[model samples]
Target: MMRSGPTPDAGDLPFELPRTTPRERARASALARALASAYPDAHCELAYSSPHELLVATILSAQATDVGVNKATPALFARFPTPAAYARATPGEIEPYIKSIGLYRNKAKAIHAAMKDIVERFDGRVPGTMHDLLTLRGVARKTANVVLGNAFGVHVGFVVDTHVQRLATRFGLVAPGASITMIERRLMALFPREEWCILSHRLIWHGRRACKARGAGCADHPVCREFGSACELRISAPSRATGGAPARAKPAALKRSAPRRS
Candidate 1:
């Protein structure tokens, strides 16, 4: 994958053991401003109807695309409709639907165990609080954030996936070698709590669509002005710009009726 340069006003990682300068903070702020403006319509792409669905979908999303997870979830949900059903399902049965996703065997075990825990401990309900959600097997901060934001509508923090991590680093949002928790902490300081969830979703969308992992489409990218990387803007020819139609009339052809040049 091709790595983009640091965002405008950004420098080396901040918040190292010794601490960092104001430049990192300014960079984070600038990039956040650009991203917030550029992606006003950002949202979670994973398809789900309920908290339990979100939980299972997020777990299945490990190293897998949201589209892939959506494909497998309908069948998985149909087979194991509830926590009790999932708890009772054998790993062998669950594996087949999600087998195409990354870490299928392990995810099968975790989801099975997690559903069982929800039933036995939480009374067959997905817990809303961070404290209760973390108790499930294979549930990490990333998964917990998904449940909190999508299922409960609680925006506790930003969920740092690979896209978020890479973008944050490029934007100088966090110091190098900083843990996810550290990144979340720094981001919390930069962005309002309300924007956290949407910000992540939008950035991920932008990263996937325009600023792709390999080659980026920097042409007229809204955030380009705020990026530290140097990129050229590519403008299509005027003929191509007119909706693939020819110009109204060629200047040379129009001037043909006029007097010839000396």
Candidate 2:
């Protein structure tokens, strides 16, 4: 039987040595490969034609769906075609375009403030570096990562949104309640640096399509079978084991049978 250990704190390392085993690394590789194959065309779902547009859309995406942001940005981007244009406008002018989205007032203020910074500090261009991007209002690591990866093709870190966080825990990549910083660090250590940008996208796509928060459709997904033996959905088990009969196991037995990562 696999030994059970104390659940790690939110920011604590999964192990005392701060390292992953060969088995864990192999599983991570397989998981990444599976996700990449499942979502070969995975890209940022936000609709934008420029880095500035992507940045603004990303800012508006907080607590809002990508489709919702897409619906709002067409008119918003048309009016404020550039950072200078947004910088010239008041928050009141921007609010109407995005009022359909949640927290529109705050987002308008942030967009106005961020555009002003871009005009003043970045010479009417979106800053490419993570540090500079963070200086803008309402821009956090996730938004900076979206801009850096999709906009600039730079891979500084993994994007750990709600989908990524939920999927990572489901796959046993990190302990439950791990902070986003810890999750990003764990993912960076697991996958190659070049794969970091698209990795999040693929995971998000999978989370949205198959591995939903409420229920996972793992039975039809072979990649999940390869790397997700511990999934709550129990997809790894054969529908019929012996004598063409459905396999049945007790709840206690199933819990004990779950894989434990080192």
TM-score of 1: 0.75
lDDT tens digits by residue: candidate 1, 24-92: 445556777787778777888888888998999999888888988888898989988898998888877
Q: Write the per-residue lDDT of candidate 2 for residues 1-262, one digit (tens) a residue.
A: 2222222232233333234444555667888888888999999999999999999999999888898899999999999999999999999999999999999999999999999999999999999998899999878889999999999998777898878876776676765556788678767766776888999999988877776655445535776555453345222222211111112321111132222110
Task: Give all TM-scores, in the order shown.
Answer: 0.75, 0.80
At residue 49, candidate 1 shows an lDDT of 82
C-alpha lDDT of candidate 1 relative to the true structure:
0.67
Best by TM-score: 2
For model 2, the superposed segments whose C-alpha errors exceed 4 Å read 1-18, 229-262
Candidate 1 stretches with Cα past 4 Å from truth are 1-30, 230-262
